[model samples]
Target: MSAEAYSKAYIARCHKTLKEWGAPLDGWFVFNVYDCLEEANELFTCELCGCTQVRIVHVMHNHHYFERISVGCICAGIMEGDILAAKERERLVKNRAKRRKNFLKKTWEETRYGVSLLWYRGKRLRIFRLGNGRFKVCYNNTSTECHKGKPITDFLTAVHAAFDLIDPVVEIWHA
Candidate 1:
């Protein structure tokens, strides 16, 4: 079913059930949502609607119980005051980008080389300074090669070149 249908159904089903007691649906609050992944569906389910596509609601509270309710983005918006609104989403995105940029800047300034979470050719990578005033990048986290035993001349060249006898590997991101 469409997201709107899901939201409407969810609200219809939950509005009264939650209101019969002292607690009510309108009494609830949504603090934040799951940090989304690029290609993978977030792991969660909607607490109010029984929908399984929840983006992972951080909090669904009714003053008495602070519970974690996994609600889809649609449910989150319809019931919880547009937590997924375009403006909110844009702010979140920009905040994340700023934080990432800051992290990379700090890393670059403090140390020229270190283990990075960034992936390269589906492998975790490491950048370390050489004794010869050059930089080297290697797959340091796994039992691997493809320049595993070779010395890279510089950061950029190491990332782009198929050094030694290994095939050219792609860097996933600079940071």
Candidate 2:
């Protein structure tokens, strides 16, 4: 289906789900699938407030076919999530970013010192030290250099913590 047409259908589905779930206007519907991905629908509860109240819902279009069916991040829904106090959410986001930075810094240190290693940007043990007690890190298509000194054993934990920041900010400002 065309992106716009699929988007409209997704919106309709979101409204239906909102009604069925007894969600208020303050709540938002998150459609977890692309119109083309014929899969069982799964519902996600807001991790922030745990209120099932959607402040903003976003319908992402994942147009891949060969991949083991992935749920489009709220594809059939309005930008909906929990109602977070603006300042509070922002603070949380900042904290999450801080955690991510720290995590990356530690990852660099570990990889550099040969104490531990991990893969990022398609390369295992990838890091560059700047000689000023700092390390450069790369992942996906993004790169950052960090100064904090820590040993990283769980980069995914840092990423998940960072998502806690990102999701709320998007709900507050973009959605």
All predictions: root-mean-square deviation over Cα? 13.1, 14.5
Cα lDDT listed for each candidate: 0.46, 0.37
Q: Using lDDT as the measure, which candidate wins?
A: 1
User: Native-vs-model 1 lDDT?
Assistant: 0.46
The 10-residue segment of model 1 with minimum total lDDT is: 165-174
Q: Show pairs that collide, candidate 1.
A: none
Tens digit of per-residue lDDT, candidate 2, span 72-126: 2332223333323332443444454465455445443364363334544345443
Tens digit of per-residue lDDT, candidate 1, span 1-175: 3645655556676665455543445645555544444214444656666766544343455566445454555555555555446235435543553444343443222233353334434544555555775665555433222244565566644443222212322211111
Candidate 1 to truth, TM: 0.41
In TM-score terms, which candidate is top? 1
lDDT of 2 at 96: 47
Clashes of each: 0, 12
